[model samples]
Target: MKDIVLYDRNCHFCKASKRLFEKLDWMNVVDWQALQSVNRPDFSQEELMEEIHLITPKGEVKKGFFAIRRMLLRFPLTGLIGLILHLPFLKPAGRFGYKVVADNRTCTFRKK
Candidate 1:
């Protein structure tokens, strides 16, 4: 199933991340949409701004850290990274780390 990734266009980090995904997506299994362009009835603008979103072809939505893990699993190489992130001992930590990064992505990038 094709996956859709909703990313913030105004964020340099988000845009760079999308470009990285394009390079890593050997199977072309994911589709990209700018968060500002999304008008999904199920997701409010504020919700989209809160974090990244991954929507499955079946219409299931995975948000924030979960979305990143799910997207990683779609590719052969990154699947292991996704699996590792979800390991019982690491899941909580991974989620926390992702949240920190997501929340400060703009500032994080600006520091560079």
Candidate 2:
């Protein structure tokens, strides 16, 4: 199991997602971080602002839906879904969906 680094903040959805991952990640594989967690050792702010990022134990950076997929990999059944999410046919839809969720995050989280 890889150490999952999730770059998120105080957004309601982001926080909810983190909690959900915590529930699903039975092996204690994830290390959640706020975008403002200044103590992060692996990722820089510039790198984070460039995209919604996640880093695996192998240190491979994933962004967008791929990051979501990486988090899902912690669960057995959901891991299969994560693999399917990487299919070429689903890439465009996944990217678009991620953008929709991200764009609405501030509003949904009442951050603005």
- Please provide, for model 2 over 2-109, each residue's C-alpha lDDT reduced to its tens digit, 9 standing for 90 to 100: 665655664667777677777888877778767776566676777675457777788788887888877776577588888888789998999898888877876765
Off by over 4 Å in 1: none
Candidate 2 backbone collisions, by pair: none
Q: Which regions of candidate 2 are displaced past 4 Å?
A: 39-51, 109-112
- Which ten residues in a row are the worst by lDDT in model 1? 103-112
Q: What is the C-alpha lDDT profile of model 1 across 58-77, one tens digit per residue?
A: 98999888888887887788
Model 1, residue 105: distance off in Å is 0.7
The whole-model C-alpha lDDT of candidate 2 against the native structure comes to 0.74
lDDT of 1 at 78: 96
Q: List the residue pairs that clash in candidate 1.
A: none
Q: lDDT per model, in order?
A: 0.87, 0.74
